[model samples]
Target: MIYVVEDDKSIRNLIEYALSEKSYQVKTFADGLDIVDVVRENAPELIILDIMLPGKDGIEILNEIREFSDIPIILLTARTDEFDKVMGLESGADDYITKPFSVLELLSRVKAILRRSAKKDTDHINYNNISLNTKKRTVKVDGKLIDLTYKEFEMLLFLMNNIGNVITREDFLLKIWGYDYEGETRTVDVHIASLRSKLLDAGKLIKTVRNLGYKFGEI
Candidate 1:
């Protein structure tokens, strides 16, 4: 199921109609008032959200949703400003489409994100004292379970998968955030710091290359 959160009646109905034609189960919302709660109770496969709304705005809603779920979200914005786009992505939107976008293009983006989201890795990864179960989406350090956010988990898994290789921030944003954009390298740094902290002594396995990116395993 997909959730469409757009205040504009015409746009909301249009999205609902297009998604319905694709055989997608959709629920439309004129505002983000109850979206967080609804998502907690019955999370949808994806969400098409507008940045400008009557209350709580889309960014706030995005943050709230990211707290417990990494459900794919596509931001619907009429703003052409790069700041809004970057902010939305940093806040955990999988993708964004500007207003007056082609319905076909929107449908294509939806299908692509869904396809990526459906992928599952059933292998277990063990690096040093860290154990990760991709299929279970759980991480343990030194035999103690440690909680990690979605991005942190993915980042750690990717680094461990490529141990000893330098991974650039741009590569992380592309592979993890699912987008290629500038001025968001700090986002990677922030998540890396948090992940390192959560891993305790095992965190030392993540090495920082002064002028490059980050590498996992040994100094």
Candidate 2:
């Protein structure tokens, strides 16, 4: 189950149509106030939250939900300020997308985040032909060892841990780089590109979303 909160009728309907086409059960709300009770009564597996909403804003609703549940949430906003992105993530959003984003991207992010949230942690994670040994801090493709840099190893580990999640550049900076690491998000892109190249045949598993960050598993 998924809940989409957006005041824009066309966008809301479009989102609903996209998710429905993918065989997901969806509920749409035009106002933040209109969905609070429903969220409390029937907790959805995931939420597509729009920042600008009538009555109560998405941030306010997010705060309210955080007080009760830690369900995965993906924010939608028109703001491109880094401060706003950081604030949204700090406020408990698992992911976010800027406005005028591709419906394909949104749907991809939705599926990826849900897959990530549903995953259980284990010392060994194997997907396709790639294997990640968290306990040993090693990665192998087809039983052959693959050497990675300190940062690359950590990055791959993080991605493997989250699996199909859509991790924004902000998320990479906050998780891999220290939250206060005073560097541009481009550093993440560089590292990701390097990691992908090193991963060889398995590199294709790391997908890049235009204007967004990357998802670390097959969609």
Candidate 3:
């Protein structure tokens, strides 16, 4: 299910119409407060949120939802200011669309976010002696808990989720980091190294793929 929070009725209708035409299940709420519970109850595949709304704004709602879920978020930015974009990214939004965005652009972003999330859930990929409790964003190895940053855990999960398949650094930047982060390839390598080192007993589960990048090996 796809949920949208937009105060503008016409714009909301347009988004609902466009995505629904493509056979996507869509629900819209005029205020963030109206549909906040829907997130917990329905678990949307993707969320389209407007930056300005009645009662609770997008940023507040984003923070609220993030307290409990990592559902992919696409912020409908109200301005072209770079700061707003940066703030939104820092707030855990998966993508952003500036005001007056074309329907084609919105559809493109929706497709990319959905595809990236789909790759993540392809299979139940767990580390040896380590498990990714999606509900908790945690990793445990040998019954000892390991601490990992949000992106660190995501990168580890992405590689492990793909198992033997080699995932390129570019894919990680685009999928896990967002396209706006500007070429953090080296960062991906660094995080993988750190996560592996911490895994200790289960470290062998992560493997370097020569020039390709990294992969998760089976136990």
Q: How well is each residue in 1-219 modelled by candidate 1, as lDDT tens digits?
A: 999999999999999999999999999999999988887656678999999999779999999877656778999999999999999999989999999899999999999998887763235666555668888889876447899999999999999899899999888999998877676588888888999999998888889888778999875
Candidate 1 has what TM-score? 0.58
Give candidate 3 regions above 4 Å deviation: 123-219
User: Residues 1-219, candidate 3, lDDT per residue (tens digit)?
Assistant: 899889999999999999999899998888888665777555678999999888888988888777656678999977888998888889999999998989989999999999998887544234444556676677766446789888888888787678789898888888788785675578888888888888885787787888778888762
> Which has the greatest lDDT?
1
Measured with C-alpha atoms, the lDDT of residue 184 in candidate 1 is 59
Residue 206 of model 2, lDDT score: 92
lDDT of 2 by residue, 1-219 (tens): 899999999999999999999999999999898676676555688999999998999999998877555568999999988988898999999999999899899989998998887763346666665667777888876556889998898888778778778888888888877676787889999999999998897899899988888888778
Between which residue pairs do clashes occur in model 3?
none
lDDT (CA) per prediction: 0.88, 0.84, 0.81
Per-candidate TM equals 0.58, 0.54, 0.58
lDDT of 1 at 39: 77
Off by over 4 Å in 1: 120-219
Which pairs of residues collide in model 2? none
- Sort by lDDT, top down from the best: 1, 2, 3
